[model samples]
Target: MARAPRIEIARGTTFDQLMLWLDDMLAAFAHLPPDKHGTP
Candidate 1:
């Protein structure tokens, strides 16, 4: 599988920050209906 780019926006950040960012991004994607990509 292809991988996304790894950007280091901040150095020495806490794990919580990273997890929050990932969760937010995932939620944003989830909001889009599956049909957007013709999945169904």
Candidate 2:
């Protein structure tokens, strides 16, 4: 069986910092090619 990855955030992280991080992550995925099987 496989375990889900754990994500940890710093104690003092601000909302703006979190948003910027999310935007970066989304932008990173924007370049990915679509799945041929139509499944995520």
Candidate 3:
């Protein structure tokens, strides 16, 4: 099986919700140590 590995919002999802999720993800990453950012 082949597929692009990425976060996929389902069809008909709202743009605002996606943006909010992305913002939260960024915030979570911002506090991590530099070396911990590469995987997981």
Candidate 4:
């Protein structure tokens, strides 16, 4: 997957930081198989 370039910002989370946070959040369910039933 292509990722956005990191940039230093003085506001809220940066793009990289947001991506990392998202990755961490999703990591909990990474082991689960794809939803073939599509019913989450």
Candidate 5:
């Protein structure tokens, strides 16, 4: 059997921080214009 990757979080992290990070990433992606260069 293969072992799963181990994940760890800092003790002081909060839910609000996680949500804020996600929002920031989504906002960045939303601002990008559609790809007019070529068909993928």
Candidate 6:
């Protein structure tokens, strides 16, 4: 499964700010599992 990146830009958002926000989101996303299927 592929998780789509979620980015929200506000009116006062700057390029650098947006980049940092994306970086944070990507980092957080990377920490999550791609799928959650398991068997007992």
Best by TM-score: 2
Candidate 6 per-residue lDDT, tens place, 1-40, comes to 9986755675778999989988997788777766733322
Give TM-scores for every candidate, taking all chains together and pairing residue i with residue i.
0.55, 0.56, 0.52, 0.42, 0.54, 0.51
Tell me the tens digit of each residue's lDDT in model 2 across 1-40. Answer: 8986754466778899889889988876775666743436
Better of 4 and 5 by lDDT: 4
Per-residue lDDT of 7-40 in model 4, one digit per residue for the tens?
Answer: 5445786789978977876785674666943445
| Top-scoring candidate (lDDT) | 3
lDDT of 5: 0.67
Per-residue lDDT tens digits for candidate 1, residues 1-40, read: 8987977757977899889889998888878899875655
Ranking the candidates on lDDT from highest down gives: 3, 1, 6, 2, 4, 5
RMSD of 5: 6.1
Tell me which of candidates 2 and 3 scores higher on lDDT.
3
RMSD of candidates 1 onward, in order = 5.3, 4.6, 5.0, 8.2, 6.1, 8.3
Residue 28, candidate 4: C-alpha displacement in angstroms? 0.9
lDDT for each residue of candidate 3 in 1-40, tens digit (9 for 90 to 100): 7988776688766999899989998999987987888654
How much is 9 displaced in model 5, in angstroms? Answer: 5.2
Ranking by TM-score, best first?
2, 1, 5, 3, 6, 4
Worst 10 residues of 1 by lDDT: 31-40
Clashes in predicted model 3: 0
Task: Give stretches of model 4 more than 4 Å off.
Answer: 1-11, 31-40
Task: Go through the candidates in order and give each one's C-alpha lDDT.
Answer: 0.82, 0.73, 0.83, 0.69, 0.67, 0.74
- Greater TM-score among 5 and 6 belongs to 5
Pairs clashing in candidate 5?
none
Please report, as a residue range, the 10-residue window in candidate 5 with the lowest summed lDDT. 31-40
Point out the higher-scoring one by TM-score: 1 or 3: 1
> What would the C-alpha RMSD of candidate 3 be, to one decimal place?
5.0
